[model samples]
Target: MKKNYFFSIVALLTVSLGSMQGQVVNGTFENIKDNGLISNWGMNFFTPITIDAETGETTQDFITFGCWPGFVFPSWDANHGQHAMQMTNGLNVTTNTIIPAKSILFNDPKQDIPGWNPGIPVDLSDQVAMLGFDYKFTRMGNDIAEAELVVFGTDGQELGRATVDISQTNTQYQYLYEPVQFTSFGIPASIQVSFSMAKEGSVPAFGSTLIVDDVIVSYAALANDEFQSTQFIVYPTVASSEINIVKGSTAPSGNYNFTITNMEGKTVSNQSIQLSDNNPFTVDVSQLSKGIYFISSKGFSTKFMKQ
Candidate 1:
């Protein structure tokens, strides 16, 4: 028989590629103990550890889902209170690779483990670039779903990459910003994110869903750079301190660069103004630390209130 059927197909592909090679889970999917499991997220399977013959110990389990059902929904599909995370594309009978849904927010999602390795080590060297999230996708036929953020540089290279893909079919949640250019040499230690709905080539008849929520990684610079500062107004909309900036004439005529954010956008206060046309600009947030604030120059930004 053809050499014993080629050694039984090489021992059945070496026991299915050595049992899929374990580790790497949980990334905000909140390792919930079921009820819509989300622990370390997975789909392509591979989470089975278990040693312990004499005294050596090892224990880790869970990883059999073929696809679809990333689980964790709670707050009615979430966006606010409870939780949020869902991915569906189903199908994983034998492998056309209809899985691979991913989720790893570091702190140890497990891996070769021995000297440290498993995303989550984020440094981003200073200013921080961009990597935002909060999505909701649902495409049936056209099937499309992809949300990624890759950053690494503690020598592992790769440094930056942000992606967002959705086959247009939203019903609500949307705000998937991504912008991390990279190339200042090195800095960003590690970070690997994922939010996929299974997409590569064929297959697209299943449910085709994707619903993620809140995964902000901060440092957004580029609110519309290049100067356009036009439009400015801020006066007693309620301030227990001091705030005044009245520039009109389409503003932006010369010196610029002004920021004062605080509604969570955190910037506190910045300045560097000199828009000719006489004078009408002043900001001191008094002593800041009150409440809502936003001045963002150039492309103009509003919102004020510190009381």
Candidate 2:
């Protein structure tokens, strides 16, 4: 029995070997292949074309190719690491091979196998306020490079979408952010971020480039269950002297009895107080000991720390 338990522990550890704690995979564009290709990105294939039948000379043509633009590149101009995803919408007639560029790298790159999918899946069960990234764009003539951030539900429904139009040419990278509103299902289950060097049906100009690095996802500090209605905000989550409970946005106004308990399941205190949806309520915790505690009133229950 002990030997079976030991193997169970080892199996659990092996399963969690490379799991990330937050956000998408490889957001820094640092993970690369031995051939210098970026990891977690969807890849396309390009076969050499024979231009001269006798000499076997080859060339590339934009007349027939994938919309992924130029092969995804890794540039030394990394924001916080050794490399960043450098995507360019340029054309070269050199004798070489090209492939489709994969965008929307997830937090987990190992799932990016089989070479092609609309996007790599991601887990966004955490409440995220917005998605942000650093980028620099260079377009010629009327061509523009755009970045798209999309969130999807388990049923394959698009929950929320944020789009940024990149038309101006920026030599220096700039910080940009987009808000991700939650759905009725609490948090989304998957996400895919794609980029376009030019709009549909339009061709990209030569030498156009878009470099991105360090995808940052800012999460709402509150737990999901605490603010499902965007009301009943409790402040000083780590209670010091007292705790503040504010009711906002159609919050119920009333007097309710409440109880506080310690981690040992001991009922520390019980009391009743009047509260208004507009006015804030203050609770005195000067007597409670410094530890973890749970507060329950009406139908809502939340946990906080006391110190």
Candidate 3:
């Protein structure tokens, strides 16, 4: 039963074709088909391949099968346009496991076919900082919905990644912006954006829907600019022991509260610093574990790495 679920997920990365190019297209979910298919994106649905006994020809039958009414569909609860994409968590009766509706800028060639590669073509001509989207989530129990953005180099090495999760129930749409932290190890060539109704360990619950719209590739900093730009500059993104927060030209001349959080959004350190002079303010991060961490004051945020 678990093996069947494994193949089903692999199918998601294999289905889409030619139109999967560059940045996200039809992000508004406005180009939905009558049968609930969205253009320029891939949604998970079951359609078995059939072969003709007489002709020896194989073809995919246009049959949509899944949890009733399918797991993904178009909804009128849009934030930017007339329609938005909705994904719900459903139970796979045969396997008794949760089947999540997923939408992705999916890649090419069927997994059963030769030389199959998965992921969307990315064009980073612009200074892309993060992914921004508007969503409304109705979570059940401890279930959570998440969205992720990943950048891959030409050699298939991960260049950067960012993720945001919806844990609380929100009837009204809320805007979310998540940063993509680059490793500065390779040249980015492709990217993949995915949204799923629930993450691992989420208890199966019906009607836990996530409505998403206006998915945009944000090019500017996802955090506040005044402090991140003028007030201070978090330098040496890849730091070993310490990170210098240099006061910028228009830095506010006063003490402020700052916190450092890990990628899981857990605050590991809470401290205050005075920013009234030209000398750089250094923060000791040697005690923190090696991984990605974010530093922010008030609403201004930025990220760094502990090497």
Candidate 4:
């Protein structure tokens, strides 16, 4: 995978990591250093900047092929704040290979993954229910982007996590809310949040970009019976012309609102349908492009693929 190569090369080089508590630091990518890099986040490569002894002028060099500095950068095109983090798949001039651009939250210098520190210490004294953020993604081709949030216990055990797939193109920013489901009870000691323009095993396509901003953690817990009462499922996880929305036995018969969104978090369809007893609601999805999409309603949601 491309990410494996990223860490292997980084093992030979040294870089700095950021730290914070209760929340993510520089979540908006507003705190930038004089070198035009986001403060706290580490870089995969660095360029030597020289200063003139007499003129006191400075000169910094950039790679001829890829964007300056690195794949992940701060951009004025923001969703909420003054800036946002932009990542793109580009050529690594040093290695002469195409790699995905990514940003990970890291704080522990003692904890290292071969050569990279990938998560930051987080005090989850107050339990969180969901993690959300605003993003705009432009997938060049078959490339897939991803955003992930992971929670770890004090013993370094995996407690919970949520993942959002970025498989569709969206020029406009959209919000994604993902619920975190824990596997065991423990005090969360750290958290890892990451955004990547391309994932491993994907065809690294150039010009594919993901712009992200305002990473937030929700404290309000999701209702235990939120979707259980009106449980439903989408048939033919992989679909073509149409799909069925099957309601659970406990679900009540009435008019229900339905919303369909592409992988980019863009809403493609929304309508209200009257469902009767023991009947499945058929939705026409033939018009949708070949890709993954989500069907969501008041308190229930699931995904399907349009082929």
Candidate 5:
């Protein structure tokens, strides 16, 4: 009878694992149809953005007056109509419409370097897992580009930041996984994610363009077993020199190996710690340079900056 009981337990575990594997899904912006569900999405700058049904390209319909012209200002007009000022490309033109690419070809004779700022905000307090789609610049003069995933509180305070670099030659899509606890942001009221392409100092030209799609966000199933078990809390997240770790509920018991690495994958600090129940530990970052750093524990990690 004992032997039979052991076999039964093994079978049950196997079934649980199978269920979990199917629960893990990619959450990036490929298109509305590709996403399991879209919480929110938008394009900056132009108005009444058009989306190519076949190509999945997004283009702006209006023009801007200044360098940061795309929707950043409400007064400027690409057209005379009031609603004609769409937010497909700028800050002032926030609208709900599809963006087309053929309208503004990267290599068109009129093409110049166009700037973009697209983002999505979600309340992940009820969900634990998150994923993001890849944005690429296939045929641009400048190969170097920047993209960022930002987390903000309901009060508009930034909780965390993550940035990634893409190569102009990369043809395949790259996805980013963020296994984080929602409570760390205190309470999940508002979170925003953004993507942009432009020169370092100059404003993006009208012709310069980038392609973005495949945005997916979902809760990880229990079977994946990859769910973040460590509940990491960093107090005064916007720290200048020193920051305290809140080990209240998510702090793991026993020995944990902690490592801090910069964006270039260089380790700055690594140490082992014996964490007590819900005890706080402090790390002095005063001596470190000001930039973004990844604080990783076990298999889970999050980003923080030193100002």
Candidate 6:
């Protein structure tokens, strides 16, 4: 009995480690040198600039009207106010990635941009979490303004918002360790997250500069519950026509048959396939109806939906 218990514990640990091995990053902005990477990734530019990779220097042609023309700005900015925005070597060494906001011009509260948008059609639909990065605000002059972290969900609705006040006397660099939760927006797939600054009143909109570094995002597990020794998962609560199955084990030579059933114990779909060594499999649910269904294979059973 003791040996059986020990092996069970070991199996559980192995499965947990395997599940955590493939958390994907929705997007990474590490190669934003010049406008090449940004433009290629569908990012619109409001400023003409050159990014020096060797020295991490970003220079913008301030004379161009498009440089700072709009009332809203998406990327980082710098102006001639005793300090110009430049990438910091210290943050780069610590985070192992180029950090934005090191060389920042005063953050104009009037310049707020749209954040994340989970493009779906439901409430409490999409959930997103971002980790890493630290923000520091320095009050050079006697100016007071407020900063905010905004999250937008599917259907272009504001899901979450957090505000921080900036003043001249604050010494400690506050880490924005806040999490945004969206429970009702029914988006089951990918979403976007953005960070920006805001102002309270019309106090001439002082240039309060804010710094950001080491950005990371976290996501929910593909499966809702633990898979037995032989199990897999398909997720995004209200899944679209397409679904993904993440495998659990890496054992060689395993043949499994997938079966789907409705809530009323009626078989909906079934397929047989042989897994290669230990690779994951993706199944298409486009033919399924818009209701709760169960997927069973090997010795495991899980629930999913098609919308």
What are the Cα lDDT values of the candidates?
A: 0.51, 0.56, 0.64, 0.65, 0.39, 0.37
lDDT of 5 at 17: 8
Arrange candidates by TM-score, descending: 4, 3, 2, 5, 6, 1
- lDDT per residue, candidate 4, 161-272, as tens digits? 9887778777867667577788888888877777766666676776778888766554222111122224676676667899888776777777889999996668999989
Instruction: List runs of model 2 lying over 4 Å from the truth.
Output: 1-22, 45-70, 92-102, 106-114, 181-187, 219-307
Q: Per-residue alpha-carbon lDDT of model 1 for 1-307, expressed as tens digits? A: 1111111110000000011111112222334433344434333334335556665565553323323333222224765335666755444443434443433333422321112233455533334455655567767777676667677788888867777666677776655556666755777666666665645563564556677754545422222111223476566545766766667666555787889877446797788977667476776677987554667676556555565
For residue 28, model 6's alpha carbon misses the true position, in angstroms, by: 7.1
TM-score computed on alpha carbons, candidate 3: 0.55
lDDT of 5 by residue, 108-180 (tens): 1111212232222344433424433333344344434444545556666766655554445443333343433
Question: Least accurate stretch of 10 residues (summed lDDT) in model 6?
Answer: 9-18
List the candidates' TM-scores in order: 0.26, 0.52, 0.55, 0.57, 0.35, 0.31
Q: List candidate 1 stretches off by more than 4 Å.
A: 1-90, 93-126, 139-170, 176-186, 189-191, 197-206, 211-217, 225-307
* Local accuracy of candidate 3 as per-residue lDDT tens digits, 187-301: 6677778787776566546668888876655533222222236656787766889988876678677887889988667899998888876787899999999766778886665
Model 6, span 146-185: residue lDDT tens? 4343445545566554444444333332333334445455
Model 3 misplaced regions, further than 4 Å: 1-23, 45-68, 107-118, 220-307
Error of 5 at 144 (Å): 7.6
In model 6, state the lDDT of residue 63: 25
Q: Identify the superior model by lDDT, candidate 4 or candidate 5.
A: 4
Model 6: residue 85 alpha-carbon error in angstroms: 7.9
| C-alpha RMSD (angstroms) for model 3 | 10.9
By TM-score, the better pick of 5 and 6 is 5
Error at 150, model 1, angstroms? 6.8
Identify the leading candidate in terms of TM-score.
4
